[model samples]
Target: MTTARRKPYGVKGAPYAFLLPATVLFSSFFALPIGYAVWLSFHKVHVFGLGLGKGARSEVWAGVENYTDALTDSELLDGALRVLGYGCIVVPVMLGLALLFALMLDAEKVRLAPFTRLAIFLPYAVPGVVAALLWGFLYLPDVSPFSFVLEKLGLPQPDLLDGGPLYLALSNIAVWGGTGFNMIVIYTSLRAVPAEVYEAAKLDGATPLQIALRIKIPMVASSLVLTFFFSIIATLQVFNEPTTLKPLTNSVSTTWSPLMKVYRDAFGTGDIHQAAAEAVIIALATLVLSFGFLRAANRRDKQEAAG
Candidate 1:
């Protein structure tokens, strides 16, 4: 009986025991915060007319009031649209640059690959705020080499801090900061592709372009999917870049992204309940979008595998 009872606690269970600390931390930090956020999202405070005494305020069930408010908020919706526009530029440009750098690095005759790779990726080590600050300085007319050059050539100086140009400025920061990581992801996957695959394509009289497009890219689809997923999530949570840029420009508001709006609402405006509700909605939307993209990617992968 003792031996039989002890079987469950053998090597198999030992790993779980080792993981107990991590599980506890997850429950305490991640799980609890998420649960509390959801709970708080559904409640609001009601204050009496006098609004004087402590007991004058009471928590009341708000049901979907906050959710509806968040959804209907023009500021948040505009922020969402702004982020979407920024993402349109950031996602493609960043990933394209990443893919280009990866391909260049993977090439047999590329020069300075190591130096370029490190230089490009070094921005990732810099905090987002610091990166924004650094880039912000570089964008300033007094400090920018580009502006100096344009001035020398007597060309019209473009305003980068306002209107549509601001999107480009913000997108550039994200692209510069993110490209190296995505490049590494793509490059690692590229490295993992067997030499035999390339040799086989070569033997088949396939040109390098044909080999890259037909075989190399298709093989690294999984990595691309992963990068795309993470990039989209990061795009949705864009906060630091705009916030940092705010000191230098008046275009950026307190609510520059949906997440930023939620933050502003919760802390800035003292509306945690509304912020919580907005947060839940954003989380749900993100999950739905992510899962949908993942499912589509999986389907495409299966089809490619079958073919």
Candidate 2:
């Protein structure tokens, strides 16, 4: 047998060289900040008598004090509950609409498929802040066309900015912005499915709805899981949409979400240590929930395959 030929000089280092920039950027932007935040999370500042002077405030080890306070804070807990409620509305509605639209797009002889898809997807191109601002204007009784029409029809114009309506209003914004992107994801997955499978189903007397429910949906389960995973993460980190809406309504408090509470602690109250702890907690929760979901999905997939 002939000896294996040696690779060219520096060949072993080529992949590392190519990855060097990305690695450096990741460490600089993501890893370093996370590490620093974790370090800050376990520490607190001690103020000297004057609360003003050189070394007046010094960092000191606080163990889990910051975390304990964060856990006990009613504001943080309330924010988390609000987010959970919002997510309960958002994730299901958004993903359902997305799946529905994708199915409709895939159906035969659908009218205006291209235009409809484009119209549904156009909102994705708009920045979240701008979208919230636009929607915010539309929510105003004085400015909204819906309100204008309600006035013309002599119907009551309810406030969309407060109370139970506020949750729906916020959820609608998220659903509208998210559905199109998710539709694209599911539709792309649907298109990748082998045409032969559908043809075989058709030959076996499967109707469009039957095929969609039985065959198409199953094939795109992976896409659904992916969208769900992302939707959860997005729901948990909801900030910009609600933040943008803040100027338009008084109902949206500064601590509308856990992430928002963290922001309030960090910049609003000048409590970096507490903020860091809250941030770390949110990050950990996100990771735990995300991995737990992924594992469940994987286990289900394995079970199906085994069957």
Please list the Cα RMSD from the true structure of every candidate, rounded to 1 decimal place. 2.6, 2.2
Query: Could you tell me every candidate's TM-score relative to the true structure?
Result: 0.93, 0.96
**Which regions in candidate 1 have their CA more than 4 angstroms from the true location?**
1-13
Model 2 agreement with the true structure over 155-224: per-residue lDDT tens digits: 9999999888999999989998999999999999999998999999999999999999999999999999
Clashes of each: 0, 0
Write down the worst ten-residue block by lDDT for model 1. Answer: 1-10
- TM-score top scorer: 2
Cα error, candidate 1, residue 252 (Å): 0.9
Encode model 1's per-residue lDDT on 52-165: one tens digit a residue: 877998999999888898899999999999999999999999988888888778877888888988998898888999999988988888888889999999998887988889
